[model samples]
Target: MSNATPPGWYPDASAPGTDRWWDGTAWTAHTRPAAQAPQAFGPPEPFTAASGDATTAARSGTRIAALAVAGLMVVGAAVTGAVLLGRDDDPARPEAGPSGSAPPSTTATATPSPDGSPAGNDPEVLVDQLNGITLPIPDGWEKPDRTVEPVPTMRTVDPYECPGSSSDFCYHATVTSRTASATDITSAEQLARQDITAAADRAYEKNIVGNRIHGGITSHDQLDSAPVSVAGRAGYQVRWRVNTAKGPGGYVQSLVFPSTVGSESLIIVRYAFDAGPDGPPLSLMDTLTKGIRPIGDSATSGGVGSSIAP
Candidate 1:
């Protein structure tokens, strides 16, 4: 016998209570009532190799493949009709948790809770389970796409193709949430200042493939930099008005604060909006930031304060 399940009958995954014949590698059309099937589904009769190396290798391969499927993250602009923040990459660290839960290294691709299930659409807020924080979603913002991995995000309007980069999509405004890198201890002010440039670039400079979507950022000016409280934690935010070579450039802001739950690692929220008259109102930034709250089964919205002290 080989490592493959010996030719036998196994339960049909598609049809309940029926067993389908397994011709070793795949299921044959033959089916019969489960009561008539002889062997239970699983490893077949003992193979010739006593060492069992082939079976062990096959099982290991299967496990790796499954893990790979579970770890993918979605970048908003990368997909069609996704009205959330879009970036080729984010400088992030895996989310810290009690069970040591984390996502793929620097990408900060939010790993679902150990339950690993979609949290579903909340009409008013987007929950970041990994960060233990919730962001208020304005009325017109597109809710997180439950079909994609649950990364905390929301944006204004439906998505559209980049002016020239048809392969990628664009959003007039988008907000995103994720854990910040933990390698060094840095104040929220420093982190936010350092991040605005990258935030601006990711939003309007170019498409994922280096195609100039908004032509390219021609210049940028600091609009605001201030100390603020976030989710009851001392935090800071920086905003910029970027000029683009083609379309109406946009404003980008980086806000950093501490997570109220678990390890208390830093959390970063990014916002990007087009600058034309149709773009989102600049006041929306302060509104969303003020709505940040901790998430829990019985959590209530206290309304994040804007003071420098907690």
Candidate 2:
């Protein structure tokens, strides 16, 4: 008898508890109650040759096909909605992450001179204010036309020298916050994980080839998820890295917190940096995160800080 499970009756991959007919090569729409199906679904396809080499090759092909399907499923789940950063791509392909290449030399130096105080110092300020929240724009950084879902605000640090070279690309930094439905969401950590997972799944679907066995995440790693406090509320944070269609990209860091007024309102902060080795120093991310504050919570707002650190 062939090792292959003969077609006739098999559990449907898509629907649980329902039996579907497998005509050896593909599944048929025919269905019947699982309990009512006979033990034998159908006879296995006969081997054309009895030689050992032929049987081995046949089994190898089947295994390879199965592996391909498994890979596709994993990639599909991870890449969905990950490219929420921007929509600069062929509509047929997944959207690539935000591109922060230095504008034409005529635009301005990658790093501009500070307006006043050094970057990350002046706290009484706000950049790209929205949703009753604000960010502390560091010195030498400039607001650019970059936005992503859930209300994105982008600030770029110019003169950011690219890795291993003297050249620089406008380093892109973005902060976005959005409220998600709390229905069935038990904890803030869960919310953060869900969002990150969704982003990854979206990215994978768009970038990875549908052919499962041959395509998947180029490379990826995720840091441990941790608990955090945001605006006096319990929250969670998660970080991960993966190679994207454009290049290496991932959520440098993300936070999710919840508030209760009438119903549960989950707030999320997603911080993304796309410049790689030429990217802004990680310390800058710390400064901005510490400086974020909900509007109307402070008496005197912070002063505008210089983008260029003096």
**Candidate number achieving the greatest lDDT relative to the actual structure:** 1
In the range 175-249, model 1's lDDT, one tens digit per residue, is 888767634756778888888887888788865456677777888999999998887899999999999887788
Question: In candidate 2, how many Å is residue 201 off?
Answer: 5.9
lDDT of 2: 0.43
Which parts of model 1 have CA positions greater than 4 angstroms off?
Answer: 1-117, 146-150, 182-185, 297-310
- Scanning candidate 1 in windows of ten residues, the lowest lDDT window is 93-102
Q: Could you give me the TM-score of model 1 versus the true structure? A: 0.58
lDDT of 2 by residue, 1-310 (tens): 2234322344433455554443334433344444442332122222222333422322332111111122234744743222123322221121111111111111212221121111213343443221234555666555444322324344554534322223323244545555564356767887788787654543332312222210224665786588876656677887666555444454456677754221235666766555366446656655665555554455425323344241
TM-score winner: 1
Query: In candidate 2, how many clashes are counted?
Result: 32
Model 2: per-residue Cα lDDT at residue 123 = 40
